[model samples]
Target chain A: MTVDTAPDTQSQIHWFLIGMRGLFSLPAIILMLSFVGFAAFTAEANIPVDQVMFMTGMVWALPAKVILVGSMLSGAHVATAFIAVTLSSVRMMPMVAALIPEIRDRRTPTWLLLIISHFVAITAWVFAMEKVRDVPRYGRVAFFAGFGITLTVTNIILVGLVYGAVSSFPPIVSGCLFFLTPVYFLTSIWISARHRVIYWALGIGLALGYLFAVIAPEYDILLAGIIGGTLAWWGEKRLRQKEAGQ
Target chain B: MSFDGVWPYIYIAIAGWLATDIWRWAGVIAGKRIDENYETLNWVRAVATALVAAVIAKLIFFPTGALENSPLWLRLGSILFGALCFFIGGRFRQPLGIAAAIAFLAAGLALIGL
Candidate 1:
């Protein structure tokens, strides 16, 4: 027997409400905490207080923001700064690709289709990927918008407030705050993986990253990413073909 | 174009911002049209996954700022313990390791005085 998947009308509304309720979700909370760490980074770097809000609103990705600030602070040329930041954020593309289709229905407007694309941050992507299947397609986008917009706006305000206050906190406290983002990211990655390919990819990628960091710190991450990814993809293809042949 | 001026930050933010946004918009367009299993899509996920892994490894292995003060052994020890605890916590409760790891590191910090 076939299982019915399309949610009923009332259930769609419920899903929409559930999405809106995502404001209180753990991912949203982690998103805010990550911004707190970023605020502390700016404060420590002695970035002008006025620019903090600007960065938060414009370069919303924390990794891109980190690269942008680091490049400029290091006296890198303008082109160099732009490239570094852009490269750091390239991961968002696949993330958006993976998440957008999961929720959008025929009624979703083109303008909205584009606008919410910005909400495909790592936290939002990870969270939405896990949640979209639970909701009807018609309501899933609204749910994403509800939680995504809430987190983004909350983070903007949090960045502003934390920027003004982070300097006052002791170094260790701020350090721990900074540490939270990457730790959260790592944990989330491990939790999200359900396939053998991803598991192999993660292990190989991490090992390569560590080895390269020790030997060539300047250009290791990008190179390691490329090589490790290619290797993982190759292995996955080989394994998949073998299984299919059976 | 003074390095210290506010304009550089704005310029980089806008340029880099657009550069970054381009991919997501492209994703939206492509995701709408292509099957999720399109062959090349695997490369994108793989690369992104690797980048994420690299980012995490960097943070844990060669962290900056206050984290720099903690000895390498201490940082590694905490993560090792955290991962072990995470595995033990099982699927639904993995986040418990995050708190446990933090507490483990905090306890070490108290003893070592970072």
Candidate 2:
């Protein structure tokens, strides 16, 4: 009287295993919390929670939330908000260029790029650049897929929590979540600062950018990144030549 | 319930996703031919990293939302303490530990009414 269902049973078992593997990993959970925490914080800060949730799931930069939220709050047209957010993300061009060579494979399908692109956040990008060096080209996509799946699930859960529990959560908890974005970036910079010139450049760039942002709210990031980066590059070249001459 | 009611938001979401995905696809296509050590690539990495750093500084110092309500010194002080935690945690070569410590310091400061 038993039903013939071996394939269905096996598929269920396989999915169960996959779910267990993803759920049990500590790093996966931590990475998930970092993503959710920041996204939820951004939502509480008056950004369009759903749009940001969707964007965090889709794109790599949470800072793009700045543009999305800012443009909307300022009563910009939806078209303008989209344009501003898209423009902010133009920086990803260099990020992808730098990271792809480390992870590309001849056998990798072109479509997988679209999938992996979803996992391309500040956290994933920084981690991949730092740790994906030794991973074989074929495995890089798998690694990121696994990591991306973890992030995607995390974002969905956190969005639900924030949306459902928006009133109950303390403002400071949200503030703490916002704090993680900056903390993560600064720590990464500290760990990766290899050259003296880089250190000085980052210091000057941050200082000047902060000052400029205080004075001129709208164009601060663009002004600082372009101007500060240019000045630092020039300063480093000059310093290198001076050392070489001596 | 009506499709028209939610269509614009949905459209924006999908469009945002697609726009960013375009660059990733380009990366995959171009990555095979590009040299990693190219000077231009290195320069791009430097600029990207610096830009991210600038964004971090801006968020902390000139924050919006609940953070804007907190005192300026408290925000800066918590970040400094977090940076210190990062250095000390790095002494153990634990990046995760440093990140957790930074998160903990911020939460702790907030809980203490700072």
Best by TM-score: 1
Could you give the DockQ of candidate 2? 0.42
Q: Report lDDT (CA) for all predictions.
A: 0.73, 0.61
lDDT of 1 by residue, B1-114 (tens): 344676866676665567578877887887676445655667656766786787778888888777877888877887788877888888645567777677777777777776
Per-residue lDDT of candidate 1, residues A22-137 (tens digit): 87876677678778878888887887766766666666777777877787678777777767776777667666765666778766676787888887777787688777776667
Candidate 1, position B95, lDDT: 68
Off by over 4 Å in 2: A1-31, A34-53, A69-75, A105-111, A192-201, A238-246, B1-4, B22-37, B90-114
Q: After superposition, how far is residue A182 of candidate 1 from its true place, in Å?
A: 2.6
Per residue, candidate 2 scores C-alpha lDDT tens digits across A75-189 of 6666666667765665566567666766655555667675666566666676666555544444566666665576566666676565545544566665765666676666665
Error of 2 at A6 (Å): 34
Top-lDDT candidate index: 1
